[model samples]
Target chain A: MLSYLINGISLGSVYAIIALGYTMVYGIAKMLNFAHGDVIMIGGYMAFCSSSYLGWPPIICVLFSIVVCTVLGIIIEKLAYKPLRAASSLAVLITAIGVSYFLQNAALLIWSSNPKAFPNLINLPSLQIGGTQISAVALITIAACIVIMIVLTLFTNKTKMGKAMRAVSEDKGAAQLMGINVNGTISLTFAIGSGLAAIAGVLLCTAYPTLMPTTGAMPGIKAFTAAVFGGIGSIPGAMIGGILLGIIEIFAKAYISTQLSDAIVFAVLIIVLIVKPTGLLGKKIAEKV
Target chain B: MSSILSVTDLNVHYGSIHALKGITFEVKEGEIVTLIGANGAGKSTTLNTISGLLKPTSGKVELLGESLMGCPAHKIVEKGMALCPEGRRVFSQLSVRENLEMGAYTRPSSEIEDSLSMVYEQFPRLKERSKQTAGTLSGGEQQMLAMGRALMSKPSLMMLDEPSMGLAPILVEQIFDIIKSLNKAGTTILLVEQNAQMALSIANRAYVLETGKIVISGTGEELLCDEAVRKAYLGG
Candidate 1:
């Protein structure tokens, strides 16, 4: 039971990281980059290529994936999303879906459809706590998630650029009036979000040990689900939502059936949405007269 | 004093609607110029166009003798023009201090602390509620926050749109007093207001707009006592 809890937390940490991307993009751009998951897939492939083909060290491979994903994210925003800034939300969402498919097919062409074995990036021995054992990857994933959350919170609260992001998220025209470069801020948001996706991708693949063109699809959907479940645009909400989702999925698999776990997880989301329409932390924006 | 801002025969359209049509005005340094008009008279539209929030279809806007035409809103701000938009559009979720901090985004980090203290001094109420979220502030407090936020940029010319809107009569007086003091301290002000009597009272020069056209222009005292102005806007 203890081992299952640890596993649950580790998995949740990855979802939390990915959900940060989703929540942030939604908050600032007011658009869902459904291609966010595909960015994770691309990050995983980038890491796999660096580690296996170039025989790079693990840290270098991780940094390479982050850089690639960051640049790719900016490119995607510039090429695919920037033009649709004034379009209807429905249009942007469809375009995001198209981008997702485009990234997937592009990966298929470059890396083929075969699943590659993901090398264990963290080789530390498992730690035994009390009567239960926790793998080093699980421990590292949890620690990494905590650090990322702290850093992000500080960045948003303490830094000028981060405050500008929050301002842009609240009111674009007002932010521009304050001399904030709205387009530049949006691009930075995409860069940061996609960079985090790389970290999530590496951690996810390390845990599951498989890399494929379609590897990011399921986890992407789950992380998005976690984002919504936590109250879409709130940062702390994503962490809580992601961790809760991880524990639920693990427990559902352990006590119930593995085949029913995904279904049960989604069912829980539906119930949460019905009970609290804005998720847990989402503030209901009341329009002032 | 030399003109800090000049608008020449500016024309603007909102899709098919001609919102601002050939409007011209000038605001000299250290002057309080008020544009007064009824609702939908293009008062806000003119301000919006001058601030680069809306593009002009024709003519020119120059700040300190440089053409501001085609300059983006953010760039216009860097050139020493700041607009306190209608509706007190403060970042609702952000703290009052954070909202003020955003106002100085174009400034250097070294200047931020000084700017912040200056704004805090101007709006002591904002300083008191500095840690509170802007959404929770009273309407009058929000108005002060918006003014303080604009001041954070240390703008040479401050443009305010409907600053007294939705405020209590007492609060309106306080806001006008602040505007007066700000202008007295050497900031050029371009004010837009529907409160014709109060606006003209403090303005060095005033323009009366009607249906996107400037129908009258004069000294504030002259307009204040003019029979036509009193009959039309001052509730004769």
Candidate 2:
């Protein structure tokens, strides 16, 4: 049971990281970059190429993936999303879907459909705690998630650029009036979010040990689900939502059935939405007269 | 004093609707200039166009002899003009202090502490509620926060739109007093208000906008005593 709990937390950490990307973009840009998951897939491939082909160290491989995805995210935003700024939400969402497909097909062409074995980036020995053996990756994943959350919270609260982001998220026109470069801020958000996606991709593939063109799809959907479950736009909410989702999925697989776990996880989301429509931490936007 | 901001033959359109049609006005350094009009008279539209939030269909806007046409809103702010928008559009989720910090975004980081202290001194109520979320503040406090936020940029020419809207009569007087004091301290003021009496009382010069056109312009005292102005707007 303890082993399963640790494994669950490890998986949840990846979702938490990815969900941060989704929640942040939704919060600031007010658009869901559904292609976000594909960015993760691209990040994983970048890491794989660096580690296996170039024989680079693990840290360098991780940094390379982050840089590539950050640049890719900015390019995608400039090419695909920027033009749709004034368009309707429905139009933006459709464009996002188009971008997602474009990325998937692009990856298929470059990397082929064959799955690659993901190298274990963290080679630390397993730790034994309370009569249970926990893998180093699991421990690292949890620690990394906590650190990312703290760093992000501080960045938003303590830095000028972060405060500008929050201001833009609240009111674009007011933020602009304050001399904030609204476009630049949005681009930065995409950059940060995609960079985080790279970390999530590396962690995810390290745990599952598989890399393929479609590898990011399931996890992306689950992380997005976790984002919504936590009250879509709230940062702390994403962490809580992601961890809860991981535990629920693990327990459902253990006590129920592995085949039913995904179904049960989604069922739980539906119930949460019905009970609290805004997710766990989402504040109900009150309209002031 | 030289003209701090000059708008000549300015026109604006909201799609098919002509919002501001060939209106011209100039605000001099160290003077309170008010634009007074009834609802849907393009008062807010005029301010928005000048601030670069809305593009003008035609006309020239100059700030300190520099043409402001085609400048983005943020760039315009860097050029020393700030607009305290209508509806007190404070960042509701942000703390009052954070909202103030956003106002100083155009200024140097070294000057932020000084600007913050200045704004806090101007609106002591805001200082008291600095840590509170802006959304929780009452309407009057929100108005003060908006004004204080604009002041954080340390703008040379500050434009305020409907600052007294929805405020209690006593709060309206208090707000006007702050505006008066701010102008006295050397900030040029361009004010838009439906409260014609209060607006003109503090305005050195005033323009009356009607259906997107400026129908009357004069010294505040002259307009206040004019039979036509008293009959139409001052409730003769």
Candidate 3:
């Protein structure tokens, strides 16, 4: 039972990291950004190509991958979302899906179909403490997740750029009128969110030590699910949802079965929705007439 | 003294339906100019076109003698014109403070905090609810927040669409009074209103629009006393 609990937590922590990216983007844009998940896949592969294929040092590979992912994210925003912004939501949604598929397929063409072993950056070191053995890598991921969340919270709320983002999300026209460079702010959001996803990809791939072109799809979906499970747009809520979902999955997997683990987690989401449509931490928005 | 904005023979279409029909107007610095009209009089479209939210089919939009006809909305912002859009499209999830912060997104790092404090002083009510979500405010409060958010940008020209929209009669008076006061304090305002009486009362100049055409252009008093405007809009 203890083992299952720890294992679930390790997996859940990853889900939570990926979910943060989604929550942040949605909080501002009010669109799901279907391409976001694929961006994670791109990040993972970029790391793989940089570290293993290019034979670069692990740290350099991660840094370069992050930069590349951020640039790609910004490009995606400029080309895909910005152009379609004036169109209906349906058009934008379709565009997002298109971008997702295009990235995944493009990744397939570049990275090939077979699974690649992600270099064990930390090599799965384990320690026994207080009668519980925890993998150092999992602990690092959890710590990293917490640190990223706090940093992002501070970045969004305390920094001038972040304030600009909050303003644009609140009212684009007004934000622009303030000379806030509304377009630049939104593009920055995509870049930052995608950069975070890149880090999550590295952490996730390290924990698992395997890669597939479509690996990001399932994890991405799960992260998005985590975001919605908490509250689609709340930063704290996404983190909380991710941890809770991870714990729940751990318990369910241990008591039930791994195949049913995915189903159980999704079922819990449905149940949560039935109880609170806004997710666990989501506040209901009152429409101004 | 010179035109801060000039729209000459501006034409806009909503997919082949000529919405703004060859509209022409100019706003001077330190003046509160209003465009008064009934429903669907293309008042908002004129502002949207100037602000680059909508592309005019055929027209020239010049600000400070420079062309603004082809600029995007964000670029238009950089040129020092802000639009306090109709319907108070405040980021519903963001706090009132964040909304104001967005208004200065493009400024250099040095100016952001100063602009923020300036907005706070203008609307103490916003300061009280600075941490509250903007959408949660009452209509009058939301309007104030919207106007406050726009002011945070420190624009050379500020255009507001219907500051009196959907407010209690008393609140409408308070908002217009604020507009007049802001103008007196040296903010050039281009106002649009269906409430012809209140709008014209405060406007230095007013244009009476009819179905996308500017039928009359005169001083605010001219619009208020005009037989057509008084009978059709100001309830005789």
Model 3, C-alpha of A169: deviation from truth (Å): 2.9
Q: Candidate 2 local accuracy as lDDT?
A: 0.94
Stretches of candidate 3 above 4 Å error? A287-289, B109-122
Error of 2 at A245 (Å): 0.6
What DockQ does candidate 3 score? 0.58
Model 2 chain A poorest 10 in a row by lDDT: A280-289
TM-score of each: 0.98, 0.98, 0.92
Candidate that scores best on DockQ: 1
By DockQ thresholds, what CAPRI class is model 3?
A: medium
* CAPRI-style docking class of model 2 based on DockQ: medium
| Candidate 1 off by > 4 Å | A285-289
Q: How close is candidate 3 to the true structure, as a TM-score?
A: 0.92
lDDT of 1 by residue, B1-236 (tens): 89999999999999999888898989999999999989999999998988888888898999999999999999999999999999999999899999998898888889989989988888889989999989889899999999999998999999999999999999999999999999999899999999999999999999999999999999999999999999989999
Model 2 per-residue lDDT tens digits across residues B42-157: 99999999999999999999999999999999899999999999998999988999999999998888999998899989999999999998988999999999999999998999
**How many pairs of residues collide in each model?**
0, 0, 6
What fnat does each of the candidate structures reach?
A: 0.79, 0.72, 0.79
Q: How big a share of the true inter-chain contacts is recovered in candidate 3?
A: 0.79
Q: Candidate 1 clashing pairs? A: none
